[model samples]
Target: MPHGDPPVLGLVAGQGQFPALVAAGAKAQGWGVAAVGFAENTTSGLAAETDWFQWLKLGQLGKLVAFFRTHGVRQVVFAGAINKPRALDIRPDFRAARLLWNLRSKSDNTLLTAVAGELRREGMEVVSALRFVPELQTPAGQLTKRGLSRREQQDLEYGWPIAKAIGRMDIGQCVVVREQMVVAVEGLEGTNAMLKRAGDLGGRGGMAIKIFKPGQEEAIDQPSVGLSTVETMLEAGLTSLVVEAHTSLFFDRDASVALANRHGLCLYGRSDGQDGGD
Candidate 1:
């Protein structure tokens, strides 16, 4: 209620570095971050990083709304992902249940978009979490000393649209292909699980292709990868990764690249139909 107070932005944080990245970016830009973290789904250390922090269960829509209203937050950004397997256990309150009742689809895009709409109705604008952290966007070109080989390039190009199409259907964000045959598709279990299956089905030297879905909620929910992705790919015996550049998130890039290099794997950033890597 005081004049000269910095604008407070509400952060609906989920898991991983996404929330922290947004919080740091917000503070760096001179904005106050009032964050709510999901129990067991968020890092407890995030409490120390926020101006105001609350731990809430996944379906506490009423509490979430009241908290932001109490803090006079007019803008909100959703970052990170709810552990979908764990999300099966959420007990939606009456408010969140009411919102969930009318949904025809419970896909990630559908649910998040609906939640954003609810926030908008409550006078809180849900903006892209990357608004302040534009640098988190993936870089273009070969990210490791090992660039794409001819076969790897074939797989990347072959799988890009398949991955994007899966995303477009709001199914998931990853597809595994080798020698132009799709071996795995990401489903409810998520990427790492899918990679494990690809290893069995595609054998060694497959490529994993990930991309931002066409018509996805831009910069809100995105395709992303990091060191864990490379580690999973290594475990899966996949030799190359091609993720959409400047559109998707690439967390822990240096660590991922170093790991990929150690294994002589290719880490290529791409945009659909736009090949900028060697």
Candidate 2:
């Protein structure tokens, strides 16, 4: 490697625009991004944003590591998320399969930690994606013109800790509640599906709360919300949304708040300190 060349930052990219955002942010910080995108999940535009890029299938762990090492990447960040279905259907190589076989639980925290451990064993540092894109961290307080109404506030209070409980169990991060009763808790079907299902069971109005898991590995994963979340809420007829602030990655705040305002929905960023309800 040339002595004057920029440091290489490897990216393990998944679905959505997050990989691109991380790449742009890393470049802005003078790091050269060598990103690998999962063909099963990442957006097509990601390749153009990277210094070196490869489209690889999910669970090709050895190939993933070899690609980064070959390109001289010493640090890596896992950005975005795999589609739940695609991730569940992964066909791991012998190396990856061994890593999985050693895990006692298939829970997210355990699995991602093992993956990061494998990278570390190969001399690559696994750093948080937030290190490059700190501005994407969701801010605390109400983000929309409409604040949570009395009923909706009660619902959030009712559901926030419950969401964390599910997350702790690696069951899910998001929960839907109405009138202090649990309407739905997200499973492998994911948030959007859970939102729609909540509407089916609870009718027009409920509060949705998504929290960071108690033991989640911040370096590799975090809850992501965006304009699409607001759109899904509008479609599902959920009236209020709250996410653990400073822990989740939020995107398109302006558009999300505008849409939420138009639909008389509430978007609030919360932390345990806000109400001691994590």
Candidate 3:
């Protein structure tokens, strides 16, 4: 873990370009990267970014740990979101079967926490993906071409607390609101699904508000929005996106913002209780 000799980091990747970004960030910081990609869910291109790569079926926890140990990986980071519904198709190995049986609840947080505990028991540390890439965190302020109007600011004020409360309950991080009414709340289906639902319910542009739970752990499950989120908004006919600043990761920031601008979307980064200045 020295300046020049970075720790060997293990990446557990699923779908999307997130894994590649993490690999790029780790390389920039001089870390040797080893990755385990899910057979059906992960992008194969991730193997190219890593020093060593292994493919595993979902629930092959033992194999994943063994691969990391063999490669001298001391720290592991999870990048990319797993498709929860598809995870049902996972074929658990003996170790994974035991781990799954031990879970009190099958929610993502419970499963991940249990896995982290298992990793620690194996003498490996689980680190945040942002450890080497803090720049991915969204800054506080208006982030797109159009600033929030008074009405939209009020909508954000009304929705922010609800979104955070939902997040605290582990329901989800994004909520769509309009005119002080909750249009849609994100659950297992994810942000894009929630956006489409809100658009259907609201009949036009809805305000999207995302926030972290009051005491949410930053190491995992930090609120994330990206170009996909912007595209979802455009398709859903949403007007604005407001997320908790400093705690949120705005993936592919420039392109995301450019897409927002092209779609005339308002993007604001603010504290849970604060309003964007006009």
Candidate 4:
């Protein structure tokens, strides 16, 4: 539908700023993006960022497929986090119902994998959000003005393995630690909520570690953080955040760094495998 010459991108949007970031990035690359928004989740402002936009129910598999096909979309990327509880209201079409019934496991991995396979079958390649947003990749070293103190580094060293172990169990990719003790383990609540919970439990500030799953599927789900994460940490009185360098995505890095520095938060990006273990 776009007049100019541009590669078509299908954006499966969810909640928060993640979808908007991805749309903006793709559009910046001269891609005509068709963003599909959820009813109560995605911000309608995302429409202006994309070449085409439509709101579809979570279970509208047929509509999603049709939107991509009509828009000549060859590349698809899912962005943002969907509130799983709200998805309970989904009225899956026959296609989605069949796919759901066929899958024995219903984790995010399984669901996304099935959807990816279906898209691939339709000649649409489901790509990672990192494809165009290269700057989002977490860089190694101290990102904020305040570098990780020896004590916090010790806690990060201890928490990395624990966080990865939890990720391996398909639980979550984040854990908050203080003095080598886990103050919180992220579950269904997500990173921001987990950070607040950790701050409440730990009192004052603590270190937050986010890591990728041991054998995570590259194209589907890669762990990511952005400015909002730093904001959450500040709200929770957290002074340190550790992310798996290279493996995780850190969007809006400059703004995140500026915010972190303003709040005295130490943001460390390190390699999980290289962090010498206990």
Clashing pairs in 3: none
Tens digit of per-residue lDDT, candidate 1, span 1-278: 47999999999998898898899999999999999999888999998989999889889999999999989898998888889989888799999999999899887888888888888999988887668888778988888998888877777777887887888999989899999899999988888889989999889999888888888777468788998999999999999988888888888888899989999999888867786355
Per-residue alpha-carbon lDDT of model 2 for 5-91, expressed as tens digits? Answer: 999999999888899999999999999999998876899889999999998887789999999998899999999887877788888
TM-score of each: 0.95, 0.95, 0.92, 0.91
Model 4 global lDDT (CA atoms, 0 to 1): 0.84
Ranking by lDDT: 2, 1, 3, 4
Error of 4 at 63 (Å): 1.6
Taken over the whole model, the C-alpha lDDT of each candidate is: 0.87, 0.88, 0.85, 0.84
How accurate locally is residue 64 in candidate 1, as Cα lDDT from 0 to 100? Answer: 94
lDDT digits (tens) for residues 135-174 of candidate 4: 7789887777778777887887788889988988778889
Q: List candidate 2 segments past 4 Å from native.
A: 276-278
What are the per-residue Cα lDDT tens digits for candidate 3 across 1-278? Answer: 44556579988887788788889999998889999998667898888988999988888999999998888888888887888788878789999999999877777677777787888888889888888678898889999889998889788878888887887677888899998899999887888898999988897768998887665556666678988899988888899999888877888899999988887899989976566684
The CA-based lDDT of model 1 is what?
0.87
Question: lDDT, candidate 4, residue 234?
Answer: 84
The predictions' CA RMSDs to the true structure, in order, are: 1.5, 1.8, 2.3, 2.6
